[model samples]
Target: MNKRLQLFSEWLQEQHISLAFITSSPNVFYLSGFYCDPHERLLALLVFPDEEPALICPQMETARARQAGWTYEIIDYGDADNPWQLLERHMRAKNIKLDRIAVEKSHLSLERYEQLQACFQARSWLNAEEKLRQLRMIKEEKEIAILRQAAELADFAVEVGVNAIAEGKTELDIIAEIEYEMKKKGVREMSFATMVLAGENTANPHGVPGLTTIRKGDFVLFDLGVIVDGYCSDITRTVIFKSATEEQKLIYDTVLRAQLAAIEACKPGVEIGSVDRAARSIIEQAGYGPYFTHRVGHGLGIELHEYPSMNAANAMPLERGMTFTIEPGIYVPSVGGVRIEDDVFITDNGAGILTKYPKELIIVS
Candidate 1:
């Protein structure tokens, strides 16, 4: 068994979990090297305490799984095959008790849950999501290296977007240039839909990019990410077009200071909520607390948004090897918005920032 599967198996053994049916693509790829997006198709990894792990995927992806380094039994199902029936047969062949079967509580749909129940009729169902999240919360050295590469590409992507900015250019125009440059760099995918909001559009958090043209004295927000070797890097930088008024400068400076404080508070042994609080305090003191809508940030990894969320209510302590984002923003309808985000990795002493795009407010003429 691979190290990740071995570790998961040991956990199952310790918890007395009979079998773990991991369904999510992220968890499956984390445990097994194989990564596939079987849209509307059944895909999973079955991990047992005393038997070899098995991968279930579409028949077309069997070779891809092998190429991705999965050396175990692959139960490839064809379109006409009933995957639930095949899974039942495979588990029964092992002659193991299915007393306490674990499933991903968050990812398993109601229909799948019913199918699982009909398959083995286990005595109890356990939530496997928490264990999987805990397992993937910390970054391995290899994963960190890939994340660094992803962050570098993200930085370059932002640079491309920043350079592509111009008066009368639409938000979609800059996004096209940014994505074109990323494609040239061999990036097959982005962590999420690229967001390039300009002028009044920036005031809306999670704004959608459209034909909104950039104009002088407008805040242009570039929120984008790049995927490298299956890992992801997210970054958000806001810059003024041509000139910045005094009010805009104040809002931008406040967000930058808040983001820096939050990043500075990221140290091992510190409470995770403290980081959010550190940032929120600055924004609140500046009277833009309500303007900051979402949580400070979220964990980042194979999935764009992964484990421990950075919010003021989460009491989890910061740990070395944990990676997340520290983004603090102020979005005012009339004044526009400013968000400075960075991908941060917690270290033994302090934090290591992965995305290195300049945070200082920029005047793009």
Candidate 2:
């Protein structure tokens, strides 16, 4: 078995799970190396107790699965009817008789779960959501390389967005320029919708870019990411169109200091909560505690959001090879918001900032 599959098998052993059915698109892609078409009827990746992984896909997708170069069994189901029979046959052939089969509760629909239960008469079924998430928390070197490359592309895209931020340019125009740059730089698509908020619009954490024109002295927030090599990079930067006001400078500086403090606190063996607290404390001390509404950051790998979340409530320990974002922001209503985010990778010595873009507040004219 490959290193990733070996690691996942070991994790399953640790969790005492005999078999698991990975249904989520990201999880399926991670294990089997097959990116399923979203329009496909039903695609599943099954991991047995002590056997190679198997992919249960439609006949039309068999070619795509084969192209993944996966060294495993491909159980292709015809498109016409009785597709579920193919899954049953594969399970029977592998002799995967388990009382408690693990499934992703978040992604698997109730109807599909019922159908699965009806097809396979198992002793019991259980939700193994955390089990799979835990496996993906500490990334391997291969995953990290892809993530770093994605971050590099994101850094370039942000540079384009920053340069496009000027007086009289609409927020949508700036977003278009950023997307154009990402495409020109070889990024096939964005991880999520690019966010370009100007002035008071920045106060909304998930603000939508509209027809509002960029104005001088307004704080412009650009939260963007790109999908490169199936991995994702998320970054946020707040810049002023012209000169920064006293309040804007203070808020921007506070967020920068907080982000730096959080990044500095990241290291192997530390609790993820500490990293969040380190940044939250800075913002709270600066009297913008409530303004910093969201969590400090979240894990980033194949999916934009993953495990080992850096939040006040999470107690997962940070380990070497784990990658996440350190984003701290302060949103002031009727004025604007300031957020400075960067991707960090945990190392044996300390945290390494994967994002190379300038974190310092940029004043554009």
Number of the top-ranking candidate, with lDDT as the measure = 1
Task: Please give each candidate's TM-score.
Answer: 0.99, 0.95
Considering every candidate listed, which one attains the maximal TM-score?
1
RMSD for each of the candidates: 0.8, 1.7
lDDT of 1 by residue, 1-365 (tens): 87888989999999999999999998999999888999999999999999899999999999999999988999999999988889989988898889999999989999999999988889999998888889899999899999999999999999999999988999999999999989999999999999999998999989999999999999999999988878999999999999999999999999999999999999999988999999999999999999999889999999999878999999999889999999999999977999989999988899999999899889998
- Residues 1-365, candidate 2: write the lDDT tens digits: 76666777777677667778888888888777778764648888888667778887788888878888766787776768565778877777867666667899888888888888887866777777776677788888888888889999888888898888878999999999989877777778899999999989999998989999998899889898888778899999888888888999899999999999999999887888888999999999999999999999999988998877889888877899888999988999998898888989988989988889998778986
Q: Which pairs of residues clash in candidate 2, taking residues 3 or more apart in a chain or in different chains? A: 99-124
Candidate 1 segments exceeding 4 Å error: none
Where does candidate 2 have its weakest 10-residue lDDT segment? 31-40
Estimate the lDDT of model 2: 0.85
